[model samples]
Target: MSSSGIWQPANDFRRVVFWRHGRTLWNAEQRFQGQADIELDDVGRAQADKAAALLAAVGPARLVSSDLRRAKATAQALADLTGLDISTDPRLRETYAGSWQGLTFEQIADDYPTDLLRWERDDISVRAGGGETRIEVAERMRDGVLEALSGVESGETLIVATHGGAARVAIARLMGLPYEYWGTLSGLSNCNWSVLQETGNARNPGAEGSWKLTEHNAGTLPEPQTEPVED
Candidate 1:
């Protein structure tokens, strides 16, 4: 605790809430949507509405989303509540999965067994369906997020409405995790979100600091924890 009882680091760091869009018919069908621009289903709309209300309490200062339909729709739910304009970025879109984009999990597994296994193992070099490598996705996701953060001032929050894969890689990239460790983070469920706070260490002024994962795959608001900090 600081002398003034303030979380002093709050002034130095920025909070980012990375939210996954709601479910789509493709998602329910276990098909890969990738950057296919699928819309949310009925249940997805309800989930977005429910999640938006809870997230609004966080008082986000900036809202950004992928240019894809599902992600745009998800961002709109929160925009309607907060009256914040949604800034769309194609770089924030899901990885372009090429031949695997519209295929079901079973289909991909049956057809591209080797590639699928590599992907599942988080091989940064393997290009799924001969598409973007995990490193490529992470690079773009990192660029998009850093661009969004440029507009956000210290002590304010930025909400990124993006896809599950994009969100995972982005979070991992922001936290400075190795590409091999990216798979350790679980995929987010529909309409769930994760939170990251900047570490505010001594680094280049314009460079983003290492971020700490504060929350992951959360459907409900984060509660204060009084547990002892582990080494």
Candidate 2:
């Protein structure tokens, strides 16, 4: 009902639920998985199912997801549960790790210690060899989130699935956290979901608005136990 022809703002306004994709083989390996196209592991599939069930409980009107296989797979599970088709956006993809794509953290530390240390210190512009800078990742993620918000009218609920680092950037920006504190934020678990609320006057979509983080890294289902069970 707004100018964009999207649904009109109800008194309740809109909410966004951001979900991190389920676990992958690389995740189990504790590898830097950026931009790598690994599929979900068996446990990851169960995680996706749990996430979908969780989103269904909240009842979002639309589902949006990163175009990457891991994210899409996770989003699709939720979409199927909620009977909503997913709208994929490549902009939501994870930060490109470049040369570090398939390497483990320990390996990166050993091979690129200085870069790793700088990154840990929150250098927004630091780049791993052939990798993306934090600034670049933030900018694209911010633009993608803002664009998604603009497309929907006030009061519409949206669900988005993306990667850990990208999720961190998006959440930090939405909550107005300091750029340096990006590391302070908790890492998102596979299939975990976070809820954010947006408020603004429907008359002016671009007008000053308030965004709040209602939930942070909450999962619909329990994480698969990595520890071995005792007999």
Candidate 3:
């Protein structure tokens, strides 16, 4: 925690594992979860168990997750494996779907045709159900992620369990990708993960704390991780 009672990110804590939560009934049905609190189905639980086993091998120093049941349950798998407690943050929750919360993709398309078309174009300004825009989601998610990183020890790895849309925003933000290019990054599948490593000297404020994307949407256990590109 920092002077403002928020996590102040530091350069020394560099490694990050972005884990997407396991599947849910809505997910299988193509329903938008948004900020809805939904639990994992049986297969989803099994997926978490398998993913946690793989992530544990990475020796994570901390575990952070969204408070949503799906994400919480997914993070619980890693917590059980690493014996590290879980820290939940509402900021890390999924994109607020607003009126689209429980609606299936087909329904959203049939009803909100204009909005659906805008979403397909990856327009950051388009708000589903008059909910959060991509920019808003990215900024809040970035804050939540940096805060979690600030709480970990130097050179330690942290696993962040969250939702698909939310995870992509965080990844794009960390990669320093421009807002317009946010559409270039796709969402992660259930139980898949990505890794981001910090590069450069801890003392160099600007040079330090830069991130590289080492892995993305990995379904199997990851091999020895490599450093992300130093930007």
lDDT of 2 by residue, 131-225 (tens): 88776776787677777776666567778888877877676776666787777766677887677677554243333335666677775455543
Query: Which ranges in model 1 have alpha carbons more than 4 Å from their true place?
Result: 1-12, 202-209, 221-231
In terms of lDDT, the best-performing candidate is 1
Q: Cα lDDT of all candidates, in order?
A: 0.79, 0.73, 0.76
Better of 1 and 2 by TM-score: 1
lDDT tens readout by residue for model 1, 1-231: 333221223455788888988878888788878888789999889889988988887778999999999889999999999999999999998888888988888898899989888887888888877788888988898888888888888777899999888888888888878778887888788888888887756143234447888788887524221211000
Q: Candidate 3: where is the Cα deviation over 4 Å? A: 1-13, 201-209, 221-231
TM-score of candidate 2 against the unseen true structure: 0.85
Q: State the lDDT of candidate 3 residue by residue for 65-107, as single tens digits.
A: 9999999999998888778999999998888878988888778
Clashing pairs in 1: none
Ordered by lDDT, highest first, the candidates read 1, 3, 2
lDDT of 3: 0.76
Models sorted by TM-score, best on top = 1, 3, 2
Q: Give the C-alpha lDDT of model 1.
A: 0.79
Stretches of model 2 off by over 4 angstroms after superposition: 1-11, 200-209, 220-231
